[model samples]
Each structure stands twice: as structure tokens, then as C-alpha cells.
Target chain A: MSSKKIKAQMRVFQELENQLLIQADKLGVKDDYNPIKIKEMEYDALKNHLLSFYSERSNIEYEMQVLGTDKKEVLIKLEKLEIYIKRAERLLDMYKKYFGKVFKTQNEEKEKIEKFLTKSRISVSVGEN
Target chain B: MAYEAPTIAANLSQDKMFSAQKAAYQKLKEEVPKEKQNEGTQQMSSLVWETVEGKDGSKTYKVGMQDTVYLAAASSALAEDEVESLSKNNNLRFRDKTLQVLKNKMVKLAMDTFSHNFFVAELSKMGVGVITFQMGLLGISPAEIEKLMSKAREEKNIAVKNGLAQVASEKALFGIVTGAKIV
Candidate 1:
């Protein structure tokens, strides 16, 4: 086929990529109050989309390479999609990496503070006696 | 040039945040394989936020040792913007430079074709000379013009290809890290 036809196909992919990127960016925001269950569910869905896009783009590039077609245009579009997917995935990874640990620490600290308060109350009662 | 790196002050509160993150990362280090613990540590270190002290007895917090995934995500968004802008600017510059080089090459080729035609016609002053020189200039015959066009095509392909490859890698293209379990 002609470069023009390839470019037209690439433009369609680019639009899809941009839409996915915007969606990814929106979902990537980590809300402190968002329940872990909900966050995980949303994250899983976002990741599935990203993975699919990445896979599709890779397949296209591979096919182009195997067929010995002029791949520069397709590669450029694929690369952009890759970037969006990566950024989205990186955000998701950050959420996975620290979210559990952070909340765990917060809970641990809260328990410790509660324990200290209870012990201080008992001590005060004994002193009054 | 207008962009300054984010900074955080080395105050006690900021120190606590950094230390908390450090401790958290250290805890995470236990989960990684013994051989890969160092690599894990390096990766975790990138998450730390740096603190800087201001002259006015104040502090600024930068993207380092973040306390929560929220903070990291927020910072990552900012970093993404910065990186995107920088890459776009760089790509435009590189493209313009390449175009300029291509432009010069085309101009030189035109001048060479003109000179060759002019000189041959002036020297020979015959139908054969005129026909050969004109054919060479018009790229009609399989001759010197064909060689020049072939070289031009090769150079154009090399220079034009892989501009966006710098933005993303072939490795990254194939290896997308999805969370465990499709659900």
C-alpha cells in the first residue's frame, strides 16, 4: 500500500491512543480516601486496556517488520501509544507499591497511639486512688 | 531553562516523612530476592523526595521519599508533563535540523545538475552531449542522476527513521507490565 494509506491508518491509532491516554491519566490519580477494593478494581480495568493497546501495537510493528514494509510511520504511532501505556502503568505501579504499606503504617501508628492513651488513663486512675 | 527542579526543606517534619518512606522501602526490600535486593533498593530510592532549606528559615518539598502512593502518583503526573514537553521540544528541533540538512542537500543536487548540464553543453556543443546532459539533469537515464537519487533516498530514510523510537523503546513496546490477575 501507499504511505498515505498507512498514514491514514496511523491517524486512527493515534486518536485511539490519545483517548486511552486521557482515560489512563484520569484513572491514574490516587485518592487517599478511595477504598482499596475500588482502587484495585479500577486499576485492574485500566491495566487491561493498556496491556491490550501495547499488545496490538507490538503486533502491528512485528507484522510490518516481517513483511518488510516501510515501518517508520507505524513505529512512530506505536511508540506514542507505548509512552501513554507506560506512563499509565507507572502510575498504577506506584499505587500498588506504596498504597498498602502506607495504610498499614498508618494503622499501626494509630494502634500504638491508642495503646499509649489507654495506658496513660490507667496510670491516672491508679494515681488518684 | 525556566524550569527549576522541585525542592523540599530539610526540616524535622520533612525528615520524618523521608525517614518513614525510607523505612517503608527498607521493609519492602525484604520481599525482593536476595540477589535483586540492591536493584530493588535502587528502584525505591527514586521514589524518595528531597528536601531543601530556604534562606528565609523555610523549606520546600520535592519529588523524593513520598509518604503515600497518592503523592507519588501526583508527582509522577508532573514529571510526565515535564518529560513530554521536553521530548516534544527536542523532537521538533531535531526534525527542523534534519529538514534543513535535507533542504541543503537538495539545493546542492540541483546546482550540481545545472552545472553539469551547462558545462557539458558548452564544451561539446553537439546533439549527443546535449541529450546525455539533459537526460542526466532530468534523471531520465540510468546514469549519475540515478546514483545521486539513490543516495539521497538512503540518507533520507536513515535521518528520518527512529525519531519517535527515542520516546519509547522496542523493549517497552513488547513488555508492558500489567498487574497480577486479569480480573
Candidate 2:
């Protein structure tokens, strides 16, 4: 993906990071806090944040090349850039699917436990609940 | 039942009250399936379930709010399988794909999200959801998460991916600015 897209993705990171930071500051030292207990968020998104920046800069440079600088040879490189963008997106998805389970909460685990325990009565409750 | 004097009743007419109750009853009645008219005895109740995983090397899967919600709303009958996603990171590695069955809802959500070929947008939405949860976990670095996010973003076309990324970023930023999290 272009740096623009990378920047876009980073903005999302920053947004979530910022919100957690705010919540940690908001709740004070005592709340029921089951769903969210430990406040373990890290900053320093700048490194990868810049990856997109570089990508965006490069794409604009590529766009400039296509619209003006070395139009003939750069076309192939441009094609490759587009391909990289597509590839990058695919990789993100695969990773997300593979890795998204990392963020499960206790509530979810508890629910799963509750559901399984309750299934013996599915036939009976199927009409009742 | 001539409820007329109380502030609650003054707020609504008896007809409105009965209509609302009737509507709810009507919906439930539909679920009951009238007197075995041969419409087929479909599922009418929920199976209550409580999942338990082996404490030793239970498979880990990365689940999101969307999946959590589905599982939360899931009847006890389905999703008996155990899955462990990242506590607040990007991947949910599992020793057995048997747990992949739990992801049926998530996969269904993805299919629904991309049902009309919105794969790119669908990927971005999942990314944002995952990233948000990761931020909640202590010690999570955005770079590491981005590395994963970038990889996940690869599933879509460039233009579409870029667009979704930009939009998600903007909304995320908006959430941050407004101090909204835990969705």
C-alpha cells in the first residue's frame, strides 16, 4: 500500500492508543473492572508509523513519475507498487485472522464456559428462552 | 385495567401500551410456531453452554469484539470448541484447528461483511477492531501491531485498501479525541 494508506492505518493505531490512555486516566484506582483489568498499552507507533509515510511519499513520487518523470520505464515499477499494495493488504488480513484471537476478554471466556454448561438444556429452553 | 392517573400512564395511552406488549408477544409467538401446523419444529430455544479448556496448552485464537459479541449471543449448542486469541495483540495460534469451529461466527461475519465484495473494507474493519483491543493490553507496541495490520491489509486491492485504511484511521482518531474505547 502507499504511504497514504499506511498513514491511514497508523492513525487508527494512534486513535486506539490515545483512547486507552484516556480511559486509564479516567477510571481512577477502583472499579469493578472485569472486562478490562490491567492497563497495559504501549506507545511508540512512530517507527511503523513512518513506514506509511515513506510509502505515501514514494507513491506521490511514483505518481509524479507517471504523470511526468520517466513515464515509460516507471510504469512497470508503478504496476509493481500497485501489486505491493494489494499484497500488503492480503498479508494484513491473513495476520489479523490468524492473530486476532489474542485480544479475547475474560467476559468472552466466561460466556463460552457458561454457554457450554448450559447446552444440556438446549432442547428444553429452545422454546422457552 | 383503567390506568389513567399515574404519570407513567399519562405519558402513554392504554392502546399504545397494549400495542407495544402485543408487538413483543407477537414476535415471541412467531418463535413458538403455532400448534404443530407442520411448519416444521425449528429451533425454539437457546442451549446454555459453559466452555472449559484444558489448562495445559489450550489452543490460542485471536478473537475480536464482533466475535465476542457473537459468542456472547450464541446459544449454548454451537461453538462448544475452545479458542484463544491474543490477549491484546495480533494473532491467535492454535495447536488444533478443531477450535476453528468457534471462528465460524467470525468467518460468517467476514463473509457477511464481504458478502457483496467488500473484502477490502471488511479487512480494515477487523484490523481496527483488533488494533483497538491490542491497545488495551499492556506492553503492546504499535509497530508490532502495525506490522501485523499491514500484513492483514494486504488482502485487499490497493485503492480499496487505502480508502478503508484512511477511513478507519479517521474514525479511530475521532474516537481517541472523544475518549471512546472498549467498543
What's the lDDT for all of these models?
0.41, 0.38
Residues B1-183 of candidate 1: C-alpha lDDT, one tens digit per residue = 011111123224423444554565566556546536455455442232222222222222332221333342233223443333433443333223223333333423422321213453223223222222323222233344344444543443332223222212222322334222211
lDDT of 1 by residue, A102-124 (tens): 78998999999999998888433
Model 2 reaches what TM-score against the true structure?
0.19
Report lDDT (Cα) of residue A3, candidate 2. 55
lDDT, residue B18, model 1: 48
Give the C-alpha miss distance for residue A80 in model 1, angstroms.
1.3
iRMSD (1 decimal) for each model: 17.3, 16.7
Q: Model 2, stretches more than 4 Å misplaced? A: A1-50, A53-67, A102-108, A113-129, B1-183
Top candidate when judged by TM-score against the true structure:
1
TM-score of chain A by itself in each prediction: 0.51, 0.35
Predicted complexes: DockQ each: 0.01, 0.02
Q: Tens-digit lDDT track for model 2 on B22-135?
A: 465456557444544643553343322222344333333344322333343333213333333321122433212222332343333322222223354355345334322322
